[model samples]
Every structure is written in structure tokens, then in C-alpha cells.
Target: MAKSDSVTRSAVLHRDTRFVPKKAVGGKGSYIFLEDGTKFLDSTGGAAVSCLGHGHEEVSQAVINQINQISYCHTAFFGTEASEELARLLTESTGGKLSKLFVVSSGSEAVEAALKLARQYFLELPTPQPQRTRFIARKPSYHGVTLGALSVGGHMIRRQPFEPLLSSNTSHVSPCYPYRGKKAGESDADYVNRLAEELDGEFQRVGPDNVCAFIAEPVVGAALGAVAAVPGYFPAMKAICEKYGALFILDEVMSGMGRCGTLHVWEQEGIVPDLQTIGKGLGGGYAPVSGLLIGEKVVEVMDRGTGVFRHGQTYQGHPVACAAALAVQKIIQRDNLLENVRKMGAYLEERLRGCLGDHPNVGDIRGRGLFWGIEFVKDRESKEPFSPETGVAFQVQETGLDPSHGISLYASNGTVDCTKGDHVLLAPPYNVTKEEIDIIVDTAGRVIEAVFAKVNAA
Candidate 1:
């Protein structure tokens, strides 16, 4: 859609005000059709949410059937079977490590729930530490948009407009970004230790007794692209949290629920978090759903104390959403899609490197499972990023979205700090085939080439 002549007539506020966005009319399998008849092969799953892809009839029917059975009920009154069973499935998947789960309406709410739970867990202890009030997070990482979640988030650009509204108790540390933070001569183990010390230093600065939790994304999502941790990074961070008695949280809103091949990204890492947040793939875009998975420690404390979380959302566990998400998970397990994710994920890494590895502007290609990120730079040797003014990542994304190129990817910037780099992410559905992978890579390659050709000409 172009700049609208009657933009003021629109009542609904869209992300951008300059243009009227096009409408997607229908979808099936790996494709969605726009009202204007343009077909797009969704490459990044609309920010990695559509794991099962466009329209899986089973999921759709599940939602309809749930609505017919029972639509809404306050959590304070009754607990529905759908939400109860979905919660059980999630907890069992963790092998009872995370003994309980709380369902919410979106990733942001799920994160907000985690932050609140962490604070309450401390107060519920036998010897309550009322001084624990601060949170420590990592830079260039995103959790969610709610006030508490945003306060913990370190994405500067997103936080700029709402800084006054965000809490001041939260501080940030260096992310485990090996591409940028790792020194030229440093070993992986040394790098992990260095990051651990930075986090430890922050806890000391804030007064360890005053800290409530240390949170981070296992695989940093949109704000920094799909950047995973180094070999021992997670374990090292968890140790630092233990030293200061702060809860450890892993926000996997975009990297959990089989998005990264395993059910949870932390499973690949060597640690289990005290609290975890998951969404995006939970309902496979069929319904609005997300969750906060509570580990045994947090659950045991709450159980022995007030026995209330002190938080509730009217739609915290909507029946339709739970039903849709349950159906989505069942399909993935029944069809063995995670095995496919592992196989295709390796192929995707190989193909991404094969297609753009030699490009002068390609700086790094890093990821795990079906998730990947391609960092762009002006000089590969120096790893110098393109000017933020160029908006290189968005340019590539928009060019690919054109009817001719026909691919939709997720674009991200400020990878260097909160304002300096560019990268695009690719997170196709978990069940995506080898042939579909070829088309996505080929389209991305061509789009990159065309965009740079024009830039060079200018």
C-alpha cells in the first residue's frame, strides 16, 4: 500500500502512519495471498511465530471447537481442561525440571509475569529479603514491551521514547555476542568467563542483596538478530546469579517451542533457568498465546507461602488459545517435525553460507536449528557496518517483499550497539521442506545482490 490520500480517516493506529498497509486475504501451507493478489512465501514466520505455517486445518478446527464448547471464564473462578492439559504437556516436556507453567495472552504479558514471579518468590522465602528490588539484563537484547519487561530490556531505540515510564532499578551488562564482543585472541571459555565477570560486577554495583533477578534471552532475538550464546556462556551466567542469590531467567519468547529445533533453546545450552518465558510458536499464529514456565524452586516457595502469584490477566488462559496451541504442539510431535527442524536447520546453515558467504558486505552468518541471522557490513575485514542512515537491512527486506522477488523476512538493526548495525533473520516454519529452503535462500541472495548493485551505482 502507498501513502494514503485519506490516511486521517483510519481509526485503527498502525505501526507507521505514512502509508496504508496491504491486507493479506488468505493463506495455506507456506504461502499467504494479499488482497491485491500478490503471493508471498513467508520466510521469517512473521517474526518467527508461524511455526506450523499459514493455515493448518487441524489447528483452525481446534480453535472453532473450543469456542463452541466454552469461550471465556475468569481464572479466579474456574480452570478449563484445555489450559490445564496444555500446561501439563509443557511441564512434562521439561522432564519436570520446570514443574509448573502459567499461560498468558502474549509474549509481553508472559515476561511481565516472570518478572513479577521473581520478585514474589523472594518474598515468599522463609527468610524474606525485602531489599531485593533490582533487575540486571544484557544490552542489545529484547524481552517484551510491557513496562516491567521493557524496563528489563536493553534495546535502546525501543526504550528511548518510554524511558521516563520505565523503572530505573534495572541495569545492563554486555551480551554474549562473540561476533562483536569476543576479542581477536580470546578463547571461547575465556570470553564466557569475561561476560560472567561483567554480570557479577553489575550485581555488586547494585548491591547483591538488593538484586531480584538476572535475566537474558538464551538466543537474543529481534533487537540483535538470532544471536546464540558461546559454549559455556549460559552456565557461567547462572553461576554468577547463584553467587549473589538472584533468580536466573531465560526469555525464549522467539527462540522457544521448537523454533530452534529443541523444545527450548536452553536445552542446547548447559543450564536450566529458574524462570523461562515462551511464546511465538506456542500457538503457531493460530491464536494469541504465550507462557511463563516456573522451575521447581520458584514453585516450591510459592506453594509453601501465600499460594497466590498476585498477578492475573482476564485472558490469561483463554480456552480457544489453549486449544489452538495444544493442537499445534500435538501436530509437531506426532509428525516428528523437530527431527525435520534439525535436518533442515543444518541444510539452511550450509545454504546461507554457500549463497552469501563470499559477498563483500556479508560479515557473519550465525544461528542454530532453523533460526539464522545474516549480518551485513561495509567492510568484511574490519566488520564495519553500513550507516544506519542507509537502513540496509530494511532495504533488503522491502526489496524482497516486492511481488517479483516474493519473500518476507524479518529485518533488524542496531546490532553493533543500540544504533549501528544491520542484519536480517530467517526462521521459516519447522516443517519447511528442502525445496522451500532453496527458494528462500535463492531469493535472499538475489535480493542482496540487487540492493548492493543499486547502492554501488549511487
Candidate 2:
């Protein structure tokens, strides 16, 4: 085992000051190896980032080649072929609906760019509505961590500490989390209509003419734990945005780039977004890359105005990052991994339900493709979440990593509200096999059972 004392004495400012994490020396495919030579099945893909898994030779070679050719070029001065190719592939994936791409280093930066572009789109219009400065997003949603992105995000616990510092121009409504948000006996259509009316009311309250955009995740991640909207929900919300002349923005940072079986989650939904943000799976953890995909309307407005987006980043289009992402995308297509994601996703869901469906604490199992969440509750019928102090999700995650389990799962709390619910997410690599899916489901069941047993014993 690795010694904590030796690892704690480091200059790196880690996420937790009280504890130092284990060192992962290497990884390949679905498993990561620690310095102690212990292996862990990467069930959550490192928070759903490593879609292609680790040590991909193709991606590594792409990065090496790009670095050998040209590593860095300021976007203002020169553009690189790597960046152009990556952008072309991404735009093409969207069927040219998103005609422009603004590549950035992280999901947070992509969100910040999207917010800025939304504001800029209005300013560039022939009859500019400078007053259209407010944004409406859904609660229990996460965009990113930067100030502007955080302002637009609706994850309450994440925003509480930064409340005073966040922008007041943003407002939030109920997310399309049917598991919890749907009223007893309410039909899906009624639930969607209610949420749509709520969004419309928010726009009216903020002055419809003053709203710039309505941003949402097609499938809510992190805060809500893989909660997908009910049928017709996106279309209803899009109608409200269109009625108010507001840009429809989809934050696909965690759900896009084939995470949801489809290349774009919006493709499943009937309507198209005016602005979109994608990351996490974009480079499949090969490099830190994310981007804002601008719709034709937004691009046209900018083209007719200044022909330039009033934003800049030093690493806006890093050649190495672009090259790695391009290679990852090519590998995904060449291997036909999305088909595997669908087949395995169905098997995983079936196995999870078969194993844990009747567990007393298992509240809801929901998700699509490789992204799935298992929410826990104090009482399944009541949907009563465990108190935040219980730390149920975290405990399950820790248990999964125990030597006996040798698995890694993504733990998240605040599923019921800002601090009351617990959930563990599973997002194995897109190419995970049936045997691996069985192991993941079996290990997950064991982890959940062990954690709850301890809670009961205590």
C-alpha cells in the first residue's frame, strides 16, 4: 500500500487538504494501475472523461506528431491544420447546424465562451436588443466552474459559496428530472408542459425582451445523476425560447460527443439548439479540449457585424490538443464504438436492474448509452434521500475502491436538493465488453450492499 505521509508532503494543492489520494502510475483500457501494483476497474471513466480510455497509441502518436510539427500558435496570428481539421470534423458531426467552433482548453472555458457568444449574438443583430442580457437555465444542472459559467449553472451547493461573486443576470427553473420533479400521477406531457410554462414564466418575470438565452443539458449530469428529460420536454422548452426570441443553448459538456449513444443528444430531441457547448468526451481524456459550437443564425449575425468573436484565450486552439482530439474522434469512428456503446449500455442497464432493482435503498436507475446513475434513498416509496451527513454515495465509491472490490465509481450527492440525495454514476469506456459490464454491475451491487449494511449496523 502507498504511504499517506510521504504522499501528503507535496507542493500540489489538492482538492482535499485532509487526505492524499492514491497514485495511479499507469492505465490501459478499462483498468488503472497504482504504484502498489493494484489494479482498479475504471467504471466511471474518471468522471466520464476517458471515453477512449487510457494509453491509446493512436492519440498519443497524434499528439507526438503535432508537437514535432508545431505545438503552439497564437490564434490571433496564425491557425494550425490540427485545429482546422478538428473543427471541421466537429462541425460536420453536427450536420453543419453548428457552423462555427470555438475551441477551448476545458468545459468551463467552453461554457464561458457560450455565455459570451449568446450576449454577443444579440449585440450583432441588425436591430440589436442590448437589453437582452439575462440568461435562464435549469436547476440541478452544472455548466462549469468559472465565474460566468458558474453563474449560468444551477447546482445549488456548488454555487452557494460563490453566490455573492456570481452574476445576477442568470436565473433558474425546474429541470426535467422526471424521477423527482414529476407530480404523483402526472402524465409525461403534463409534466413537460408544466416545466415549459415555468420557463416561460421565468422569462416573463425577467422581461422576455431582456432575456438572451435559455441554457440546459439535454441529459442532466453530476447534480442530478444522469437524469434525462421526459419525451417532448426539449421541444417544449425550445418553443418557449423561440417565443421569447431567446437563444436555445444546450450544455452537452458531459453528455455530448457520443456519450449518449448518439453523436449529439439533441439529435434525439426534435429541436436544435442555437448555441451548444461540448467537452469531457471530446478528446476522450487524451487532452484538455472543449468547444462552443455556434449555430448558423449566431454565425450569420457575427459575420454580418464584426466578423469576429470578441473573445480570446492563449490556448484557444492548442495544436497538440486538437491533434489528440482529432485522432480520438477518428479512432472512435473507425472502430464503430458508438454501436458498442448502445449494445453494452443496454446490457449494463439490464444487469444493474437485475442485481439492484429490489435493493431497499435503490431509488431510481436512469441514463442512456454508457452514462448511468444509481440513486439511493432512505425509503424507496417516499423517495426520501439520505441526510447529507450520511455521505452514502461517497461511502459506496470508497467501498468500490477497496482491494476486495478493485473498482472505481463516480460518487455524487445533492441529488434531491442541494445536499440531501446520494448517487453513484457508472460510465465505463465506450468499448467496454459484456464481461466487463457484468463485473461493473456485480461490483457496484456489492459496494452498495456493503455500504448500506454498515449504515444499518451503525
Per-residue lDDT of model 1, residues 344-375, tens digit only: 99999999999999999899998888899999
Task: Specify the poorest-scoring 10-residue window by lDDT in model 2.
Answer: 1-10
lDDT by candidate, in order shown:
0.91, 0.90
For candidate 1, which ten residues in a row score worst on lDDT? Answer: 1-10
**What's the lDDT for residue 396 in model 1?**
91
List RMSD in Å for every model shown. Answer: 1.2, 1.3
Which candidate number would show the highest lDDT if scored against the true structure?
1
RMSD over all Cα atoms, model 1: 1.2
* Number of backbone collisions per candidate: 0, 0
Candidate 1: lDDT of 142?
A: 89
lDDT of 2 by residue, 252-319 (tens): 99998999898889999988899999998989998899988999989999999998888999999999
